[model samples]
Target: MERWKINLIVLWLGQFMVMSGMTMIIPFLPLYIQEMGIHDPHEVAVWAGLIFAANFVSSFIFQPIWGGLADRFGRKVMLLRSGFGMAFVMMFMGMAATPLHLLLLRLANGVISGFMPAAVALVSANTPRERMGFAMGTLQSGSVAGTILGPLFGGVLAEWVGFRPIFYITGGLLFAASVLAAFLVKEKFDIEQAKTRPKMSVFSGFRELIRIRQLPALYSVTFLIQFSILSSMPLIPLFVQELHGSGQLLAFYAGLVGSVTGFSNMIASPLLGRLGDRLGSQRILAIALIGTGLAFIPQAFVTNIWQLLASRFLLGVFMGGLLPSVQTLIRQYTPSGMESRAYSFNTSALALGNMLGPVIGGAVSGLIGIRGIFMTAAVLLLLNALWVRLSLFPRNQVQKTGS
Candidate 1:
């Protein structure tokens, strides 16, 4: 296989490990807190929200810093840093003795948790432009598969060996990704560019991105894509519970509801990627945005597990296309020497969505009901679709940048 292809595969698995490790603790987060001596349900909920948000808070602040480093040093170095750093931090999280300790460790985790986007940057930097959509699509499948399965795996492993062990296992997998990346991933790096690149402060780089007409829109697409999808995440289990009532099998069914979309997403990603390559990424992205917006409405009104599963599966088909198109658009618009920086900033935008999506979703559910959040998510995605139409396809062309 070609070197770029090799890097794509390595980074695909790396992204999977990164996502899987990050998500594996979710199934039992509150339980783990209880183990740490927090018995009050409301206090557990508060701590859980705080600890989860801590990761994104620190990650949002640090992603641009890492991006600049990736451009200056090499994308691989950043990948290894995130991979190994996450491994150590996840292990530390497993060893937390108190909610404060877990919260602090989760904060530390955000500082090191750019591995997935870093891997995306590495593959984006290395892949040929024509194949960018397909490569990203394929790569996304891995992470999506991991995300879909992570909760299921977490539940099973928690039942079998307990929650702390899940963290250790997740940490081991990330460490293994570091080893694989160190040994197998290769970049046709420009040492001269690294040495000669002007010192661009992160603030100036943000300003510079704003100077580019399409970049901010592309960044918004990145943010909205994450925001729309994650807005449904914190409420899925509750929705499932509402559909079927609480039982011994509630967790299992809830996980199944979550995993099914990932199944369709993993299947549709590469196909939509190739479709985007042939049909124009912006056009397909528009289709996906609207399609996903529509998909959420059916999910909002589902009366049974089958109906919800079908709605989510449909949602997954369009969801598969959104990010690859966004990444392709990013590749088209970014300048030659700043691939890592743009992706890193884009990752920051994604982190911001993650930081806020669940909070907003939680608020919607609290005020309305379980199904109401899905309606809110649908409206948000529809608005985002309009933004894409206005911002990206203004003249029916993604004005080719001077790369």
Candidate 2:
């Protein structure tokens, strides 16, 4: 493989391992807090929400800053910094004695958690334009797979040893990613440009968010795509419980469904990316939306765990095409030298989706049960698909030739 390809593969692999470690902690969190003698379910729930949101809050605050730094400094150096910073935080989190300490560490982790963006930047910077979507899709698949494995592994480790041991193991994996990143990656920071360019400003970054013309459409797809894809999250554990499974079995099924989705995404995203390359990202995105919207319909009617898992697997296959296509479309619309800012805007939209998706899904699921959430998400997706098809993809010829 070429050097860039090699580097991307290494970065993707490291991402997978690191995310696997981090994701493993989520499912086992309630159990860990209970083990710590926080017997009050209300307090445990509050802590859980705090723990979940802490990282995102910090991440949302820091991503634009990191992205700007990456633009000036170099994508590789930032990647290494992110890996090392996360490693340190995860190690510290492993050793935390209190929920406050853990929450603090999670916040710290978020501040430094730009590894995915760094990796994406690297791919975007080095890959040829024709292959950008495919490469990004392939890269995304690795991280998604990690989301599947992390929790499952964490659950097993938590059961076998304890929650603390799971953290230790997770930290170790992050440390390994740091080491690999430090050695394998290389970049040439633009010292000349840094010196000549006006002082970097968050204001300028925010300006870029406003300057892009098609951004509203891009962000619209972003919100709907995330809302569609993630609406299943809060209800997964409940779904497992309703099936009358043990906690361990619940963890296993959670892993199974997650693993299936991520695994299928891994298998399918690159193909979609390639398809986008051959056709156009707009076309691929439209088709992906339709497929994803249609896929959710079956999820509402699943009678068994196997059926649910299969539905999710199919959902992943359709959803896999979305991010790569979105990223590519955004890149096409953005001016040169603005990749980082553009990406930060995209990340902001995604974070907004993340913040709202679970709450909305949880609320709907509570009111009408899990089935209702699926139906609502599906309808939203279908509407989103129709909008994109009419407004975006059909104008592809005008877009591609820069009329």
Candidate 3:
């Protein structure tokens, strides 16, 4: 096998472990806060929200800094730094005695969390241009698969071994992933060329990258894709309750509703990516955005859980096409020496979306109700689709940039 192929495979597994480890705590986060002696239900809810957002807040600030370093040092080194740093921090999370300690550790984890972006940068830097779409799509599948399964595994392990021990297991998984990358992943970074390249401060680099024509639009698309999808996620369980009523099976049905989209997303990612490679990433992105926007409409009106599940599954198929196409477009638009920086900025955009999505979702749900939140997301996505068509697909630019 080619070296890039080997790197892709190794990094795919690494991404899977990283995503799985990061998400494993979600199922028990509020419960863990309660264990820390926060007896009031309202206080537990507040702490849980703070602890969860801490990671994304810090990650949004730091991703570009790490991206600059990846351009100067090497993507693989950044990957290892994040993988190892997250491993140790996650383990210590198991030992946290207070909600404050846990919140601080989550912040530290966010600061150290560059594994996914670094993996994408490394694979993007090394893979053949023609194969970029397929590679990115395949890589996305691994992360989605992990996302779909992580909570399930975490929920089960929480029952069997309790919450703190699940943290230790998650830490072990991250460590094992780092060790695997240390031995297996290969990068052909040119040390002397990197050393000779002109240096730019983090802010300067951000400005320089944004000046590129298509990049800012692509970054906006990245933010919107995440924002639109994640905004409805926090309300899904409540919506499920509205459709199904209270029962012993409520949790099971909620989990099913949550994971079904990811299941279809995992299946569709690589297929859509391959199609993007043949046609045009810009074209696929437009169609996917429109499809995703239309998919959200049904969720708003669904009278039962089965209708909601089917709508979510359809939404996932379009969701799979969104990010990989954006990544591919970023690569095509970025200059040779700045690929890592561009990807890092994109990751920051994504982190910003992650941080804001649930907050905005909760606020919107309060004002408009849960079903209306779905309708609002659908409208925003449809507007974004029109934005993509106007900003990214000018006929002359399409001919100039190629598919």
Candidate 4:
């Protein structure tokens, strides 16, 4: 059996558990805040946003630190560290008696959060160069599948067992995942040589990376795409209610829309990744951006749930393509021997998007009606398509490195 294949399968499982633990709390986090004695509805909403954003905010600060460590030591260590660290924090979260305690735990979770990106870096470093797209796409599919199942399972589990128990359950899954990874994943490392090598600080690495012409734009695309997609999430339930009015199944309907995208994304990611492997990630990325833009148009005008579902489904397929393509580009251009650092920096861009997307979505909702968010996202995607075409296509020059 090929080592890369082994890494893929084990990391796939690890990533699935990691993604599930990350998202499983979203549906009930506000409820947990209320359970901790917050009664005012507005206060609950504010605290929910703060707790939710807290992880990403810390992650954005800490990614480069772990990335540098991964480059010097080995990615697997970083992966195990995050997996175990997050597991402990999640279990501790179950004991929180106040919203502040919960918020602090979440912040700690973010500080320890690099399991997925570390997995990506490990897989990217190990895979055959020609297969980076397929590996990343395939790995991404597992995470997407976990994300799809997380909220659905969490909702059901919350109803069946209550919120605090859900935390313990998720923590157990993460711990199991870390233990499995400790046995199943392996990396070839030279600690003595790694120690001898002149190590660049994370900020220095970022500075060197920005000097690459294509990287900043790619990073911007990472930020913009994430911003555009997430900008709509907070509003989805409200939009559903506006369309159908209040009912018993209203939350279910909103969740259906949320889950459907991950389902489609999980299904399409690997297939589209293979397509990019053959057709070139640049070509696939442009098409995905345009397709995503077109997909959003119908969503903005949709008068019914089915229409929204169909549009979101298509958007998911394109989204599945967009992200892997970006990763492929990052892989293509990364400086030799610096793969971990490059992915870490890129992960920061993504973390920033996760933090800011909701804020932008919320602000947009305040100004324009719910439909405007979709249109705004669509426009950003379309413009990005043009930017990609103009930037990468004309020169066909993706600054090459042995990486």
User: Weakest 10 consecutive residues, lDDT, candidate 4?
Assistant: 394-403
Worst 10 residues of 1 by lDDT: 394-403
The TM-scores, one per candidate, come to: 0.93, 0.89, 0.96, 0.94
> Quick one: ranking by TM-score, best first?
3, 4, 1, 2
Count: clashes, candidate 4? 0
Off-target runs (Cα >4 Å) in candidate 1 are 246-249, 394-403
Model 1 lDDT tens row, 75-179: 888899999999999888888999999999989999887787678888988888788889989999998878877777887999999888888888998898899
The TM-score leader among the candidates is 3
Q: What is the C-alpha lDDT of each candidate?
A: 0.85, 0.78, 0.89, 0.86
Clash list (residue pairs), candidate 4: none
Write candidate 4's Cα lDDT for 1-403 as tens digits. 9999999999999989888888889889889998989999999998998998899999999998998898888899999999999999999999999999989999999999899778988888788878888888999898888888888788889999999998899999899989989998988766677778788988888998888777777887888877887888888989998877897889879888877888888988898888988998888888888998889999889988888899899989998897788888887888866777888888889989888898878887888866888898888889988777766664534333112
Clashes in candidate 1: how many?
0
Deviation from native of the Cα of residue 7 in model 4, angstroms: 0.7
| lDDT tens digits by residue: candidate 2, 1-403 | 6767877788888779767866778878877777767879999999888887788778877888888887777777778888878877887876777788888988898888788777877778778888888887888788777877777788678879887877767777777877877787665456577656665587776776656546667777878877766766778777767764665677768657656777887889889998999998988888888898888898788878888888889988988898888888877877655666667667767766877788787777768787888888889988887666655654675467456
Candidate 4 at 158: error in angstroms?
A: 1.7
Candidate 1 vs candidate 4, lDDT winner: 4
lDDT of candidate model 4 versus the reference: 0.86
Query: Residue 317 CA error for candidate 2 (Å)?
Result: 0.6
Badly placed stretches (over 4 Å) of model 3 are 397-403
